[model samples]
Target: MPLLFIQRALMIAAVVSGLSACSLRSSPPSFTASGFVADQGVMRVWRIDDGQQRPLVLMSVYSPYSGPGTISTLYEYQNGVLYQIKRTDADGDRDSIQLRFTVNGTVSFMQRQLATQRQKLSNDDIALYQYQARRILEVSDALNVGRVRLLQGHWQQGEVKLCNGEVVKPGFDKQAENWIARRTTNNHQPVSLAWLDGPEGRELLLVANDDFCRWEPTKDTL
Candidate 1:
């Protein structure tokens, strides 16, 4: 089956489970991390919510394994509704789009920057942005309920020091552990790992010698 269809099916199942859980529970986590594999690359998501389960912010980073540069998008919510969307590309072009919506979903502000030129987005472009924003929210909600989590940590000998400073053995499989060990051996430096945890299994997303914490967003930044 196509990936899109599979994703939608997962989202439907997750929504049902989430609703049932909500009836019996108070709320989901105030902060959560999740991700999904898209056709182009892997997309990691970070979400922050009010204690009551209303989302306050959602951010995603898309990193292609090859060919394309990374892109990041931030979605801010007010009163449980999307208020602003900001997207940036890390390529030489430096493409970016910013849109602010009114309470009624009207675009109150919109800006697009490509390279060094600033341009206005057409009506179709604005609509597409709105659609993408909603779609991402839906995907995020599904991943959260499906128990898919994104974890980041620094690798030490056979263990990982998580972003929160907790040191623990990661649940990665032997092959993944071997890969990390080999990369560390080759780099001669501390390596960082980002992986997705879910009911199905764990999948490695990134392995780099760079400091993952340096660019990671804190609650204050959101």
Candidate 2:
């Protein structure tokens, strides 16, 4: 079987096991991060939740190894109901979408931008966006329950310096560690690394020379 297929199978199993475990917790963390592999890219998700496990905000960054471009989406919920969704593409066209929903799940505001043009979204498009927002929330909840974490940091001398300035060695497998080492070998500029930590194991998500911190969303910004 393919590696991606195996990973997906393991993730599903984790989610199933976690359903029982999550119910036992009296209080869950207010913030969490997780990610998964999409068709041709990797998606890193950050979530902020109310103490009762109701998500307040969820943001995801999808970076394709080869294809169109990177896309970032943000979902905001009010009283456990999704109220806003924003998506941006890092392509030349700079396509973007923003939608705001009312408490009764009706769309209150919607806009789509492509380069210099602004367009109105059809009812079908609005429905699709709403569907995607809910689906992302479900996936994020499963990943959080499964103890899957997404971590990103700056790579320096075989150690990772996290956004908060904490430097530590992550528990990555030999293959992943080797890949990082190989990529950073003789590189002068700083490299950014993103990876997944899950009950199954650690998986490398990205290693690029880009400055990830500049664009990453913080609690205040989110």
Best candidate (score: TM-score):
2
Q: What's the lDDT for residue 70 in model 1?
A: 77
Q: Which stretches of candidate 2 lie over 4 Å from their true place?
A: 1-23
Per-residue alpha-carbon lDDT of model 1 for 82-184, expressed as tens digits?
Answer: 9999999967578999999999999999999997799999998888777777777877776676677788889888778988889988778888878777788
lDDT of candidate model 2 versus the reference: 0.78
Against the reference, the lDDT scores of all candidates come to: 0.77, 0.78
**lDDT of model 2 at residue 50?**
84
TM-score each candidate. 0.83, 0.86
What does the lDDT read for residue 151 in candidate 2? 82
lDDT of 2 by residue, 168-208 (tens): 78867888888888778888889998888765777888888
- Cα lDDT, model 1, residue 181: 72
